[model samples]
Target: MKRSEQNVVARSSLPWNHSCGSKSFAATMSTKAEIPHFVDFFKESHWSKKKDDWLDHKCMEKHGELENLRTMCSQPDAIPMSQEEMSVAVLGKKSGYLRGYGVGRKPCNTNTTSRDNGEEVIILREELSSLKELNDTQQQQLEAQNEQLAIQQQQIKAQNQKLEKFQEVLLRCGLLSSDECGEESTEGG
Candidate 1:
């Protein structure tokens, strides 16, 4: 046999190519049909098309849900959603975005077990500090509101006292009857 034929025979004799069989191998060598690489072949095959279609359907479904959420938000009576809640709704629970991970930080691949524990502790401490800061801010705002409310109450009391004195003067001048004054006071209260 010629060298090229000999090479073909040797190649076809390999364990993986045994499925071709001798006659089919000869026919394959004679045929003009190209043998595709596995990856390229799979790319054009049914399974690949099925997978792509499935993925596209999932993306469309998610897009539709997001559109609905946007529409709901545009409505006047819609409750406001926080960024974290929106992200969790759009992305699944397992997404790292909700946990504030994988952005400008290295993956936790420490050699020592203690190092991992230390990193976790640091993260917890940071979260705790942030929560404490929020609590302090809310407390300060509540105190301010309370102070304003107390001042308002005092002003209202002063206005009521002035109204009472004016009513007494009206009574002395016979402008308003005592029954009318009493009724006005009751209504105001």
Candidate 2:
């Protein structure tokens, strides 16, 4: 009947079905709400107190068997790209939001795409070169070790020859018995 009453009927999405018994009841059940914006984004959101609530059904059941992941999705980098072109470069083939699209599989909108550039390849090249250099150094060290081993073997061979000659001389001079040299002692006593 009034402007406020008319406004209430016009604004309300649903029709007023229930008949108010009292004037106070009708006053309390008006179309107007304290919240100026009727559309509440987080009005129906529920907060999870437990960590296992976020996981998949199977994972939730077998929490102990599998790794308890903090998040299944990959986290984005911290780099900021303010410009549209930078956003385009960062986003790459996944610019549906900026370009305008109704429905599409959204690319992982993480800043980790910066690594896909040539700069990362250059970094990888440097790492590979350094590893190769280290390998060469290790190879050289191994060769040096082999040379030292060969020298020691030659010295041992020379000493062994000298000892053999000394043993022969001792046997000839009757200083060491043949039995004492290698064979068992001949004298039973």
Clashes of each: 0, 0
> Counting only residues 3 or more apart in sequence or on different chains, how many pairs clash (N, Cα, C under 3 Å) in candidate 1?
0
5 Cα displacement, candidate 1 (Å): 56
After TM-score superposition, the amount by which residue 70's alpha carbon in candidate 2 deviates from its true location, in angstroms, is: 7.0
lDDT of 1 by residue, 34-130 (tens): 8542222212221234345422344445445555665676689998554334435764455343311112212442244368578879999999999
- For candidate 2, give the lDDT: 0.44
Give per-residue CA lDDT, model 2, range 100-126, as digits (tens): 111232254334355455567898999
Candidate 1 to truth, TM:
0.42
TM-score of each predicted structure versus truth: 0.42, 0.42
Off by over 4 Å in 1: 1-110
Model 2 residue runs over 4 Å out of place are: 1-115, 183-189
The C-alpha RMSD of each candidate to the native structure, in angstroms, is: 16.5, 16.2
